[model samples]
Target: MLSRRLISIAGAFSLALTITACGTTTRQQVGIGTGAVLGGVAGSAVTNGSTLGTVGGAAVGGVIGNEVAKKKK
Candidate 1:
């Protein structure tokens, strides 16, 4: 279980990095990547390693991060 969670977290981070490195990432994209990382970590911790919680938290965080970035525009 622990290994699976770690793998998921690693995969999430890798995906975020890949997205960010795809060239010409805007503020919103950066926010999404950053938020996903933070949110996934937070969610996993808060939900006692629940995958659904991690994903939901990442989705929520991504939206919030994007909105916050938009405010600066």
Candidate 2:
């Protein structure tokens, strides 16, 4: 159970990173939008359908994505 939980957490982090990386070529606005949507879904799934987790994840993902996009430009 512990291992599974750890794996899940790691997977979520990796997915967030991958999404942010993919948006790096685009503008910050686009990145933030896409990241928020994707992150929301991922967060919901990871958190077992928690609304707060989804929202929080979306916000964080948006920021990270925007930063990445800005850096790439």
Candidate 3:
């Protein structure tokens, strides 16, 4: 059951990325979006679908993504 749910989430995220691949976006934007999706998915799995967990995960993921995508000078 958990595997199926994760697969579904991955599939949905992939589809969304593919659909928007043609759009112009910064690396940071892409990173944040990817992180948020993955974080939300992970949070949902870890917390058994708890809303707070999902949101918290997304927030954390977004911050991590932003830092990761930062331009190094």
Candidate 4:
């Protein structure tokens, strides 16, 4: 039962990420979307579908991705 729920959550998250990623036109946008998707998946797995963990992971991942894709002088 729990496993099924986790799978469902992960699937939904993935779908949502894919949908959002479609509009990205820049490396940074792509990076953030990719990171958030990966992070959300990892977070869900680690926390067993805890909403806070998933959201926090996405937020953290977005920040990391933004930093990684940032233009440098």
Choose the strongest candidate by lDDT: 1
Q: What is the lDDT of residue 8 in candidate 3?
A: 46
Decide which is better by TM-score, 1 or 3: 1
Residue-level lDDT of model 1, residues 25-70, one tens digit each, is: 9988998888888788778778877989888878887777777778
Q: What is the TM-score of each predicted model, taking all chains together?
A: 0.84, 0.59, 0.69, 0.69
Write candidate 3's Cα lDDT for 1-73 as tens digits. 6675566467547744874586898888877877777776777678876667767777787678778988999
Separately for all candidates shown, the number of backbone clashes (residues 3 or more apart, or on different chains) is 0, 0, 0, 0
lDDT of 4 at 12: 46
Kindly indicate the candidate among 2 and 3 with the higher TM-score.
3
lDDT of every model, 2 decimals: 0.82, 0.66, 0.72, 0.71
lDDT of 2 by residue, 1-68 (tens): 44544454555556556755664445666777667766776776778766677677778878877777
Q: List candidate 2 stretches off by more than 4 Å.
A: 1-26, 71-73
> Which candidate, 2 or 3, would have the higher lDDT against the true structure?
3
Among residues 3 or more apart in sequence or in different chains, the pairs in candidate 4 whose N, CA or C atoms overlap within 3 Å are none
Per TM-score, the best of the predicted structures is 1
- How do all the candidates rank in terms of lDDT, highest first? 1, 3, 4, 2
Please give, for residues 1-73, the per-residue lDDT of candidate 4 as tens digits: 4775477467646765675667646878767777777777667667777777777777787778778888887
**RMSD from true fold, candidate 1:** 1.5
